[model samples]
Target chain A: MKLLTYFFQWLMSLLWVVALQAQAQPTQPYSYPPSEVVRIHSKILNEERKVYVHCPKVDSADGNKRFPVVYVLDGDNHFELLAQYIDYLSRPDVLAIPKIIVIGISNTKRTRDLTPTNSLLNYEGKPDSSSYQGSGGNEHFLQFMATELMPMIDKNYKTAPYKIFAGHSFGGLSSLNCLLTHPDLFDAYIAVSPSLWWDKEYLLKMTDEKLKHGSALNKMLFFSDGNEGGRNSFFHKSLVKLEATLAKKKLKRLDYRYKHYPTETHMTEPVVAYFDALRFIFKDWEKQR
Target chain B: MKLLTYFFQWLMSLLWVVALQAQAQPTQPYSYPPSEVVRIHSKILNEERKVYVHCPKVDSADGNKRFPVVYVLDGDNHFELLAQYIDYLSRPDVLAIPKIIVIGISNTKRTRDLTPTNSLLNYEGKPDSSSYQGSGGNEHFLQFMATELMPMIDKNYKTAPYKIFAGHSFGGLSSLNCLLTHPDLFDAYIAVSPSLWWDKEYLLKMTDEKLKHGSALNKMLFFSDGNEGGRNSFFHKSLVKLEATLAKKKLKRLDYRYKHYPTETHMTEPVVAYFDALRFIFKDWEKQR
Candidate 1:
């Protein structure tokens, strides 16, 4: 009986040592592709703006090459996501998209800067006191991008003329607003599940009013909707209406594609939507030719 | 004319100064989710191996929580990709998948470690003098994972028993090989565009021989193919054959899914395949349940 107790005590001591060793092993952080946070003082917004920038590695053969820039909103959520996608898709083996700079615009006042019109109405068109109180400062946000942010980026990075504006949800609503108001700001636009229900479809109305039928607007556009509420939800209906409106315009030189993802939720749709949107925008990017 | 020349020279001097200022801006690296590289000596493989590990942040409420692990092949290509996906999917709002540790197994010898057979033939059933030499070390590789690497991970990290094995191309072939030879090793498996034409459909034939008809083999399998050659390419046909072979067996309790991406290339397919595979694997996970 005494020997048995001694064996048990020895086992406990070994266990304690093993456990301590496990905790003591040294670990170092893994390296990721180099990206940077660029804090720019925006006069239009009257505050300092922080943007995450991811530039592709300089090609040894052509060190002076310039790259296209993709300025994505809701940077805190989707900047790293886009940066990862661009890095993988633009690899020499993949070449699905070209090497480009990704500029993620982190938000300070999210609802204020993303919404186009001031209203307390939520997704259901019901007044929500807490959510949309300080909304509708998108015009100033665009000005900040155009005059302050864009000039700062152009003045610094090896950037090409081709630019893409991408966003999700309220950010998506602002993307459409930018397309309608400042059409030439970006060569392409991506709106992933834009909240067309905002202000009783404010951007939808503006898109129809601003775009002329049979007019040439040489740009690429990719928009998508996820199963937000259901098949008969306003989200689906709004996207269908947007597609119909675009089709009815018959605008020359406008290359556009609309995709509906029924299996994905609003939160999960960005994973696939951004990828498909990249494919649609770069459909003409034939590698090695 | 003299005044115009003097003005042009002054403008040139100002532009040079501005360019120099642009070049002088120092940007710091953006912070990503902390991941680590762990090196272990593998007795089975007779070499040292390095694996990248990404763990979820410890919840303040439950600091001692353990996580499911996903051991993915081709660490050089897909380690960061899976890490990013897991981080995004397991966010507070998204919560599509449970917080899990991602272990990316980096390759020392691509062909030797991933291939199941020693044949020196290429994808086209032709002998390639440049590639596929000194192959057929997958069994040893699995032994390494089972004995050395897995024990190291489980000993050092807070790990649960629910493991997943994910791979692409040759790595995918090895994934299937593991599923066949050691079905109990992983709870789930993801084979993205598996090279089924390896060694004259050896694994395909092995799958038919090994899995009993109408037997209970509870596992989640996700396999896919891209537009490698064409509609009737060997890559497509081989995947079709594997799907058919699995269906023919009528394997009971085997939750399997097959996807074909006609628009995606072999190299670009993993971008979407990995995302889709994760969704399929975690389809039943309800948020806030």
Candidate 2:
């Protein structure tokens, strides 16, 4: 009887301790919509490339439905922000945009893969050798993406034909490079604070060269610059020049929007710029739906 | 010898199948900064309430650093976004705002807790009994937050003295209600598109009565309205009236901002409003830091 009493006491004490622990420590991690970190072997790059992908939650109604893909550069910096925006925008209540499969391509040798020229000349036309060494591999990088990454993603995910190419800074430079060099690669493009000053206005010159006057380039483009180097700075001037060049083109079907966030800093611009870009890209999405 | 040969062949085929499966499958879930879902037993509300808490990642430098807490309503809709925003804004590279804790208070009987009054009248002043039944428990809800939720949170977490209260729509109404009734409860308040037409603008009248004219109300208030109900909307009118009332008071030490997102829809307004509010609230954060 005494042993039985002791056992009950012991059990009661154990339960009490558990209750205290529960009170002290909140249980369970807050659940976020699930996303995956995917790795695919790229033969063109000759190395494994990692990408962050976030797909919409599939329900019974969307059993066989496919989604558009938003392939963003600088995955580590901007992937989650894009994913969060997409999720919120596509919520049943919000419905600002359709559900999307976000593909965030993280970098390997950022300058090398993102820059269009092998020149060591910096934004200021100074030969910053250490920074610009082995800088011209963007063509090869895009080739790897076109031949390897896209095919792998298309094969594995429930993807529609529509795709968006998005990037910031050097990544932004690469985005414009991709669009000009291979216009058919993506249906839409977003370049937030592109380093247009790269290699003595290489992209700005390329923009003027590649795009034709009165020609049709059917795609949605969102290009933006913040108060990066200020109003009179070359960075801002380069953006203005790019805008003027595009205006000069008068392309027949190129739906593009250029936003100047005078209030936002360069690092902070992507947050608002990405949101504005998505909204611009899908301005008539609801009406169409 | 024949049995050994058969086993070797079987092993080789199994290895090949494994390799194929590995190629097909992309392993691992994308990691997000961790957040906790805390279920605290609430005596005031007489129910177990669940709140989502996200703290900044503490490092060796922050061995015992306490952080400010932001208590936001509509947890299910906005918690993760706030968490994502705080995390990004406080990043070393993008130090727009200081690192802070985010607490997302989800709803249980939202109308009961968020509305300032029990009237069944809709925004159009028609009785909407079914939609608004069991309304006007906001005072009790605030009581629950102040006496129960905040105390419990303060006890469990490493919290600083400062706190921010944020909400949208009806939740926005509740936020304004809290600011007026319990000004000491939080250091700052954010109301994103507050439903000012509630109970024939009960809180708007309260705003006039509660705040003393030309008196010091040393707090940060951010209130905004989207293009809700359109240009000539009563909703927009009410917001304008609220702004006018505050202007009329000319209250001392009241740091406030009123934003009108003419391009944003009622639903889509919160995303930009919340971001803008955070930026507004911490506009001089970098300078101070």
Candidate 3:
């Protein structure tokens, strides 16, 4: 009986030690909601494109629910950020925005596809032939997006009709270009620090020509610029001119806002601009929904 | 030979179909860097505290490097956001800030631990028994953080001496409480729309009493208030009074800034306030580093 009691005591001590150690060990690393990488062969661009898709977790209450989709450019740079924002803002506590699908279209040939015109002229309006070579393929890229990528996303995901296109820098230029050329493609567009100095301000001119006076756009557009050079720089000047042009057009139902982050740098602007743009785009979403 | 050719053609056709189907399927879901749930048995709190710890991916060059830590309250709400921010800001392309560890302290009893005073009075200076039942354990909570949590983190992770404490609302109340009482705990403090109205404007009163005339704090603090009840509300008034008190102190080496987000609400404030606070705290870090 004495031996048995000692044995039980030892066993109890061992279990206690094990429990204490187990409590100290952390649980498995927590993971963010997974985003998938989708591969599609584009007939228009004649390239195999890889895109990142982030979908929301659906509850039983969200039965047969279709989500709005935000297609962002420069997938490698900004996909995760947008995905994070969409998830957070759409949480049950924060119904600031609805649960939306984020489709980040990764680049194949960034320079060739993002620029709207073929020109050697740089931001300084000087020739830089090597950099500007094969630059005017944006139309083909847009066709690829319109005919190939969008269809693929809509076919695969539980998608709503409301679509948004977002981008930055060259990607920002591409976003604005799409807004001007294929305004019907997306319901909203975000252009963060668009390289408005591209090809002798080609898109700025296009924006003026395409947006007819007193016309109905029925879309939301949020564009902004950072202090790229200074107040006197071409980058700032172009954004001001674009804003002025939009004002001049007096396009009815073209819900748009141009924000200038004077305190931010070109590189650092996107972190804040993207959040602000989302808020501006979906300001009335909660009440409307 | 003809039979063999027919077999080869059939194989090729089969292969093509298989490849197309394979391409249509999405690649594995892209994952954000994971954060672990660390359970620490706090003798003071008499319960297990779960903290979300997000560590940066260390490369060969960073083999022996240590990182500063930011301890944020309301882990469940804001942990992911801070993790996302740290990852983006510290990227090679961004590099606005350095790689840092984020420790988000999830709540067990939020009200009991966050409030500084034992009072039944609510934000409106009226008695509310049910809501303020177990308030005024902040000092004990701070003690738990200082004695139990910080040591465990230091022991397990590669930690730098510099630390930051961030909180919002009631959590913000705790942060300011810590700053006033245990000033040595953190290098920086961020209070986003702090509940200065707690206990009939208790913290606002405490702030004035704590800072000695021309005292050297040698710390950084970023405090902001949103349009939480409008310009005439006590929320705005309390923040203004706090700022005025800090200014009157004229404490030496206390690098602080007060930002007012007239556009943001109490709940939506953290989204922008946190970003702005981070920028303010790390404004001189790049140059200094």
TM-score list, all predictions: 0.91, 0.92, 0.91
Q: What local lDDT does model 2 show for residue B229?
A: 78
lDDT of 1 by residue, B5-98 (tens): 6756888999999889877865657999999988888878878889999999877965788999999999989988888889998898988898
Pitting candidate 2 against candidate 3, the one with the higher lDDT is: 2
| Top candidate by DockQ | 2
Q: What order do candidates take by DockQ, descending? A: 2, 3, 1
Top TM-score prediction, candidate number:
2
Ranking 1 against 2 by DockQ, winner: 2
- After TM-score superposition, the amount by which residue B127's alpha carbon in candidate 3 deviates from its true location, in angstroms, is 1.7
Q: Which parts of model 3 are misplaced by more than 4 Å?
A: A1-27, A287-289, B1-25
* Candidate that beats the other on TM-score, 2 or 3, i.e. the better one: 2
Cα lDDT tens digits, model 3, B1-289, are 5655675688899999999987776676786787898888999999999999999988897979999999999999999889888888888777778899999999999999999989999778889999889999999999999999999999999999999999999999999999999999999999999999998899988898889989999999999998889999999999999999999998999898888988776777798888888888898986686
Cα lDDT tens digits for candidate 1, A59-178: 796578999999999999899889899998888888889998999999999999999999999888998989888999999999999999998999999999999999999988888889
Cα lDDT for residue A26, model 2? Answer: 53
